[model samples]
Target: MSQHALLNSVEHSDLKVITQAGAEYGDNLWFTPTFPQEFRAVSAYYPIFFHKDPATDTFHAVALFGFTHNDNLFLDGDHWQAGYIPLSLRRQPFLIGRQRFKEDGMDKEQRVIHIDLAHPRVSRSQGEPLFLPLGGNSDYLDHMAELLETLHLGMEDGQDFVENLKRLALLEVVTLELTLNDGSQHQMVGFYTIDEARLAQLDGETLAELNRRGHLLAIYLAIASQSRMRDLLARKNQRLGL
Candidate 1:
């Protein structure tokens, strides 16, 4: 397939859903389209959200599509004080959207593809308006992918794992600790891993040589040529019936 098609496929793939917090928070973090025919969808182009749980060493990932009330989405605003100064200056950026699902609980949720909205819950009140981010393809997937990579590696062996990961590839390393909607906590680490066989097969110079010359695209292409390590963990879990 063409590069464009491959990227599209990567961006549009379905997500697996899992719940790690309060049982009352419901199962399946993914959401479904609430009113696709009437409104312009913002997250449809890329519909996945990832959450990592360090305490239990689990990863919660979901893909969701749908409409949210304006009040629930994140919006840029201005802030002001009682004085003459402009209040807009005090406005801060915060998550204000709700997770809308086709059904209220996990029963039907298991049958669909969706992800939990990373924001607060949406109120069903009539006056509420859900504001959405401008980018249809938010960095949600990229963020999640990076987050999962970091968290998974950390779980494998702590600081030693991180050091080894960097030595194995040419990407920056970072870690994130997150609190999910249900009040559960988790962690994720980030780094890239390359396929040694593929790098050696290159008729030209070595992988290190390509990286040293700042051939970023070529480096990523070579790294991705290997199976995404993230999937390996997922498969391992499935094999053990996790």
Candidate 2:
């Protein structure tokens, strides 16, 4: 259940948001949505992949944290082991909302921050306060606002990145079979990755165009992120005490 409320200092003066990473805070997700803008940081720690939305048949980038559903290897008690957490996860319990205001005889829409009142991260005490004693936004709240703004812009860029990859046929289906240390076999499918072979065969002009669009770097980062899969497996193995 979700109860989204437009965040303001008056109604939520005592609102304290738990900022720690833990399962109780719904941080047990196996993967999180990501964008090309943060792929450099994401690819450095997690395997960057593409996920297709079955309902819309559209694609978007993701950073994988575990092999299967609801399994986040990065979650160890209250600590997130990764050096960087995807902004999608970090901005949870809050989202961008639009408000229309009259300006110069025209309606102008502006983005506003909305918080999920029913989210597990929300609390009455023992967490970061959203507003200061004087009723102004706290530093933490300002940081969240900035993060939401960045995500709002990055999501638009991600759509273009996915479309360009699709147009170039750079996404290829991939299947991974893993045998855990405890003798459990897991087969993962329905995921895709950048087709390095096809990416290399693109004409010079197309390559130049992709580079000019700042897509080539994200592509290479996604490919380079594959190496992190080994580290992920090791974490899984260690968790299993293998």
Candidate 3:
């Protein structure tokens, strides 16, 4: 379980986070949650798809890094091969938390930064420091705060984007099957993607509405990203020496 706590300079002044990319730093994920705002960039490098959360039965957009669990073809030694990494993956060990505060005798909730002490990237030595020697937030911490804020807002927008797609009946279940060079077969199930046929059949008014909401371009980007599945298969074959 994650041991998350509100970050404080007094208690976490010595906390350091590893900046390298590798499985040791918890980079073994095959996919990460992504949002519509990041589709253009993420679609360029990774195949974008949607998966339903079992706990909530809600669909979420994701960027695929590998075909199987515990695999990330993008990780080569300590470097990430992709030119762009999803915000969800980039903002590791830190997350936005809600804090209730009294402002002018009114209770209001504010977004604050929180850290996971048990995350693998966290360390006491040989990494980026969270605070300065004189007791102030480090440059890294400042950047993290900005990243978390962006991620929070992007996710909120993504929820509405997905809801609109569902309301329009544009999403459909998709199954991917790949055959490696060595004649081995792999099948991926329970994923959803935009139905190009239905999308093409949308009325002009609906298309105009989607375009107004900026979801039309995002939907096309997701459809175009499926071409990268071939690239992912090649990476897997190369790793297997097939």
Q: State the local distance difference test value for candidate 2.
A: 0.93
| Candidate 1: worst-modelled 10 consecutive residues by lDDT | 85-94
CA lDDT, every prediction? 0.29, 0.93, 0.93
Candidate 2 C-alpha lDDT tens digits along 1-242: 99999998889899999999999999999988999889999988999989998999988899999998889999999999989999999998899999999999998999999999999999997789999998789999999999999998998999999999999999999998888878888988989999889998999999999888889999999999989989999999998799
For every model shown, what is its TM-score relative to the native structure?
0.18, 0.96, 0.98
> Per-residue CA lDDT of candidate 1, range 1-242, in tens?
11111112244333222212221222121221111111112122222232234586433221221112121111113211112111111110111122335665543322111223332221223212222233333354444344444333333332232233344443332343434344555554432233355445654444455445434333343234223224323332343355
- What lDDT tens digits, residue by residue, belong to model 3 across residues 1-242? 79999999999989999988989888899999999889999998999999999999999999999988989999998999989989998899998899999999999999999999999999998789999999899999999899999899999989999999899898999999989999989899989999888899999999999999899999999999999999999999999998
Comparison by TM-score, 2 against 3, better one: 3
Clashing pairs in 2: none
TM-score of 1: 0.18
Task: Give Cα distance to truth, residue 18, candidate 3, Å.
Answer: 0.6
Worst window of 10 by summed lDDT in candidate 2? 176-185
How large an RMSD does model 1 have? 20.3
What candidate 2 gets wrong by more than 4 Å, as runs, is none
Ranked candidates, highest TM-score first: 3, 2, 1
Deviation in Å, model 3, residue 241 alpha carbon = 0.6
Residue 111 C-alpha lDDT in model 3: 91
